[model samples]
Target chain A: MIEHLPALIIAIPLFGAFIAPLFKKKQSIAAVWAILITAITVILSLMLMYQVRLHGIIVYVFGADKPTIVLPSGYKVPIRIMFEIDGIGAFMAISATLMSFVGALYSYSHVKAESGLEKYYALLLLLEVGILGMVLTGDLFNLFVFLEIAGIAGSALVGFRNYRGEASEAGIKYLIVSAVASLMVLFAIGILYGEYGNLNLAYISRQVSLSTLDMIAFGLLFASFAMKCGSVPMHYWVPDAYTEVPAGINPVLLVSTYASLYALFRVSFTLFANVSISLERVGWIMSVLGVLTMFIGVTMALVQKDVKRLMSYHAISQTGYMLLGVGVGLTVLHNSDALAEFGRTAMAGGIFHIINHIIYKSLLLMTAGALFYVTGTRNLNEMGGLARKMPITTLCFIVGAAAISGLPPFNGFASKFLIYESSYRLNPLLAVFAMVTSILTLASFVKVFASAFLGPPLEKFENVREVPRPMIVAMVILALLCILFGLFPDVVLNKIVYPAVDALINVAQYQSWGGLA
Target chain B: MISKLVTGSGYWSPLLWLAFLILFTLIGYVIYSRGNPSYKKESEQVKPYLSGNAEPSKEKIQVRASDIYWGFIEALKEYYKVLQAIHTGDVRDYILWYLGVGTVILFLLVGGA
Candidate 1:
């Protein structure tokens, strides 16, 4: 039963997406189906994670052929498009599902106010299907296919409220950029095939011999994924697109970015594990970009009048931290023989931050959504003293704020602490820059909290009331999870983080899986 | 060997050239700013005389955000147009275009392989 959890996770939402359109005129029925689908997917993802932890790696083939092939070196590779689960994939899947679940829960009341509820729910489900498939797929081309699905779905969802010119414009911009990025990725994949004729990740990993072609392919692929992940220079589209999307859709968009960034690591490390890919270059590029991204993103966030845009910039900044962790790991991988251990530390930190980002960022987006639900605006300057009228919303928003700012005993701090500690051990300068960025982030969120929630009551919001129970329930669950993950970092580390780390560092494991030595 | 070295060095040359170009721009801007009396006199600054009486407003004379990078974005506007042109409100056109692109990519992959 557990063995088929991977397929089930993807299938439920997919089936729901198809079924949702049939209930086009029946909004209530569609909502119930979407909820049921998301709930089942979340439970399945949890169970899958448990199974993967109990076992080593849950490697399931789509269409199995020979059991395993013995190479000249007697290493056996499984012959199929594998849906291999390690800690990272499991954790990402769970976080994505959980957020989707919460987002759906919050949407019942929030989405009731909007028109085209059918298309909205259907696109959301399709977006989930793409995300799940991207996380689970082991083939590079399959990953690209899933990437396209996710990108198109995201753009459609972003432009869901197409009446607004800004939404349409932002969605168009996102679409163009996404298309170019995908093309570049496809070109890189072409180069890889030319160099080593394989599309399966394991095969590529086995056959990858360092060359100019390999390096160029790495650069192109990395750059494309970096753009998709909203890293420094290529991040201009994120804030506009995220902010312009209908309020309920913000969390969905954030999760899409989260999933894509994880895809970057998953694909990159799997393919380029052993090549002399210049970790120093990769590190400097990522860390420098990360520092600038964090600084610029947070600074821009500070002066933003619109709460959604502010949170959007902060999303860009959070990507910076994750990049910094990965960069530190890459840097250490080259300079020292303790590469695997230290790299794991950095990767673990990065993965932890990714999970933490999903929780807090969604909560914050939901905060924005909740505000929009009542006040009909996302501008923080227009909001004030909502702490009295919308106490639960304000509390949830504060928890989100605290987590994002990386304050003590919050999920953000735990993951960020690991990133900082690991980077400090590798290179203290990056560590320093990371610290500064963290402080700036804290400052920006503080400004948001102060301006939006803490000031004297605005006359406009005088009659504003709290959102319904379901939305509150969603926020409360996320807030509690934030604290839970923060307090029990070791539990998360032991079950999820460590196994992912082990999988990443173990080249032999990859080689064995790919039938290459 | 010569081609490899040339290609390798070619990458850095542009970066170096860019550095110099930026430095020159900075120096020019500084000298211009220093020499021009209008730079210091914010109150006296008027919209550049464009053969007509410039309208007065409280806003400072600065390029709007959209206008600042209009050229770069305008260059890419064609792709956006192409995308928007495909918005025929028909799902069939989108599928056809996707099929076309996908076929090209697949051909490239197989042929390149």
Candidate 2:
């Protein structure tokens, strides 16, 4: 039963996704069922994380041969794709499931009047399947397949409001860029295959030797992953796409991108372990990019009249923090002297920031969605004194804003403090720049709060009321979790987070978990 | 020689850098004090251009969305035209670009041997 847990975690959603399409004639029931499916997935992921915590890494292989017939030394380790869960994978899976669930629940009313509600629900489930698969899978090729699934669903959801020119335009841009990035990844995978002759991540890790070809493949793979992460120079489509997407859909896209980033770390560690390339140089590049992205995104967001566009720019800025953490970790990992201490600190900070970003960013986006629901507009200039009508949403948005701006006593602040503390300890200049960015982020969120929640209540908003009960429930749940994660961060860092970071850092342990080496 | 002088980590380079910094500071100070009058004008001219008769009230001024950003995007209209022409929007063109770049990469990597 425990062995099947890994596959069930993803399979339940994948099956529900396909079955949802058949219920096209009954959109109402299908939407409820879709919500139920995501709920089940969230529960399963919690159980799965608990299971991984008690036990070690969970590995499930396909096509088992009667108690696993002993294989010869030279023979391949059975061609089955793996779904292994450790600390990071579990955290990502839980986050993805929760976001997908909330996004699904909100969609009940948010998308009720749409033409193809059934199809929307189905794609939502499919996207959950893709994200879950991306997080849980222990194979590179499988990761690519799931990436494609998520990408297609994301593009479709972006274009769901097909009548709007902006929607169609954003969808097309996302589709083109996503397709190009995936192709770049596939081409890199092809190179890895020709060289290593295997697609399993652990096996590839053991086999890959640092070489010119390998380095080139690594560079291409990094570029592709960066594109997906919406890293600088490749971030043009994010604001437009996120702005055009329905509020209910924004969380799914945001979480999926972070999930992809988690996959990137796993694959990168596997392929580039002990390579000649300088992880520090990459780290420096990432730090500069993070600095640039944070300032630019916030400044642009400040100028936006549309609430969605502002939130979209905030998404870009949040991606900067993640890059900063990961890059610093990689930089330290590249140097032997700093590998033992600084590397762990940096990597932990990075992983912590990833989790924090997921929480606060989703909260912020959902708050925006809730505002849009009540006021029927995404322009902050058009909204005023909504705090009086939607008190719960106002509280949630302020918490999210405070957290994102890295204020004290919130999940965002805690994680970002670690990042700033570690990065600054590593290099004072980088830390200073990061601090400046954090201050600017605070200034930007203040603008969001003032324009959207404060000031004289617009006349048009006189009749405004709270969002639906279910959505409020979802938002409150997220808000509570954010506070819990903030206050007792040690629980998360020690139990859930460390194991995940350990999973990536300690390749030997990963190898021993499976029969890869 | 200029590149060498700039790149070298020597006293001469430090002197050159200091000279450049001083020059930049002087120019920046001047610019900050009097650089772009348009910015100053925009802030001071928040009241609709009165032309000395107490400009039209806020209720009379209508602002539209299209009036923003498109102007900057339009400033480089020729470049945008070139960009638009190159972007065929066909899936095949995207694929071709991907494969062409892939082939070139492969050649460089394998050719390195």
Candidate 3:
């Protein structure tokens, strides 16, 4: 039973998604089913994370003679699909599952009033399956498959309120871009498959000769995944999609964005693990892109009036921090001692930021949703003195805003501190710009807090009240996490981040899982 | 100490930071309390006033969120022009930008390699 846990993790939510429509008329019942299934998925993911923590990497081969069937002595390649659940994959899976679980809970209140909830829950589960599969699958094509599933489900869910032309418009844009990006990924995979006859990541990594075509394939894969992750210059669709989606789904969708970022890291660090691809040069390109993403995203965020759109832009900016950290890690890979010192710290900073960003960004988005719930307005100009009316939501927003701005004693500060301190050693400019971005982030959120929550009370909102109980509970879970993760950085860093970093930078660990040893 | 992270370059211990924050805040409060330490909550005194003049009604005095950053926006007008021009929100423009970024990445990674 334990041996089958990997496949079961993906299967359970999938089966639940398929069975969801059976309770279509009973939205409440379907909601309960969704929550129950997602809770089980979360438990399974935690167990998997724990097991991976105890043991280094647990490889599960599918449809083989026994689950861990070693290939025959003559056949060196692995033909069957497999799951390589290392610390990094498990960490990301745990994040994806936790966010999805909270999302499912929040959806009970957020989507109950809306129609077609059965489809909503189904799409939500499928979305999780996609992200989890991308992070967990050992095969490259399987990543592409999951990428498409997530894109389709995300697009459909984005337009869940099709009657609103805004949502439908955003959904269509998402679908078009998602399809184009997915095709590019498929094309890149095709190039690699043509060169090397296998689609398994470990197999390709072991045998990657890095021909001219292979380099082009590498470029294609990076571009596609970067686009999917909402990197700058390619990030216009982010504001539109994030603003139009249901609030509860935004946090989970945010996970999908990070999944793409995870894909970016995996392709660079794992798929092209050998010397042929020139890690330093590729890493520099990513770092430059990261700087551009950071500056452009924050500058644009500074002037936005719609509260949700502003947060989305900030989300793009935060992604820049991760890119910078990991990019530096990639840049310094040629130096073993440096990789051990600054590079590992940079990578840890990037990965730790992923956890921190999920906690605070989702809470911020939910708070924005709570404001929109009671006021029916996403415009900040229309808001005034909400702090008095919705004290809980306002408090959550303050915590979220402070954390996101990298204030002291919050999760963002701890993660950003790591990135800034380590990346500075690599290049002082990287650290300076990161700190500058942090200040701008604070300014941006202060503008939000002042306009939306502070100032004189509005007569129109005199009778307005706090958000629903479920939504508040959903937010407080994250808010408390913001405090805990902020105040206890050492715990997460030692226990979670280091192991995940090990899973990433140590190519030998991944290769050993491929039966190379 | 609990909740502390140490790297090669520096260390962050929230316990110590929190302790200092509490200490400083207490001293500041005590010092400030030596002056006007207490206030009465009177609705009439809480109304907005500007330069010893009666302020406009709250509705009339409402500041548009967009207006909050006018000074910053004015100083960076040219920079914002480029940003806004690039972010035209049109499909063709964004697609072209995507292709352009991909092209640059291809040259940098592949060409250099």
Q: Which is superior by DockQ, 1 or 2?
A: 2
List, residue by residue over A1-517, the lDDT tens digit for candidate 1: 6667777788889888888888878897777777888899888998988887776566666754422222223434433566666666787788778877887888888878667888888888888888878887767787888888889988988887888888787788778777877887788789887876667777778787656676666666776777788776567778778887766566667878877787777655667776644555556666676776776677556556677887888999899888888777666665555455465577677878888888898889888888878888887656667788999999999889988988766788778877776777777887787788788777677766766677556667789999988889988988998877776676777777767766665655664553322
Over 4 Å off, model 1: A65-80, A334-342, A514-517, B1-113
Question: Clashing residue pairs in candidate 2, if any?
Answer: A88-A500
Q: Candidate 2: where is the Cα deviation over 4 Å?
A: A66-78, A334-337, A513-517, B1-113
Model 1 interface CAPRI class: incorrect
Q: CA lDDT, every prediction?
A: 0.72, 0.73, 0.88
**Fraction of the real A/B interface contacts present in each candidate?**
0.00, 0.02, 0.63
TM-scores of all candidate predictions against the true structure: 0.79, 0.81, 0.97
Q: What is the interface RMSD of each candidate, in Å?
A: 16.8, 13.4, 1.3
- Model 2 per-residue lDDT tens digits across residues A1-517: 6657888888899889888978888898888898899999989998988987887777766555522222334676535666766777898998898888888877787777788887898899898988998888877788889999999999999989999898898788788878888887888788888997878776677776657667677667776776677665456677777888877787788888887678667755645665535555556666676676666666566556787887787788778877777677777675666655556666676788787787778788889888877777887656667789899999999888888888755778666766776677568877787788788778777777776787555566788888888778878877887777766666677877777777777666665444433
**Superposed model 3: Cα runs more than 4 Å off:** A70-74, A514-517, B32-34, B49-55
Candidate 1 matches the true fold with a TM-score of 0.79
Model 2 achieves a DockQ score of: 0.03
User: For the second chain of model 3, what is the TM-score against the true structure's chain B?
Assistant: 0.77
Model 3: per-residue Cα lDDT over A1-517, one tens digit each = 8878899999999998999988888998888898899999999998998888876688888887777663544687878888888888998998999999889888889878998999999999999999999999989999999999999999998999898999999899899889988999999999999999889888888887657787888889999899889999899999999999999899889999999999999999988989534888888878877888888999999999999999999999999999998999999887889888889999899999998998899999999888889889999999888899999999999999999999988899998999998898888998888999999999999998988898888889989988888888999999999999888888998888888888888887787673434
lDDT of 2 at A312: 82
> Regarding lDDT, does 1 or 3 come out ahead?
3
* Candidate 1 vs 2: which has more TM-score: 2
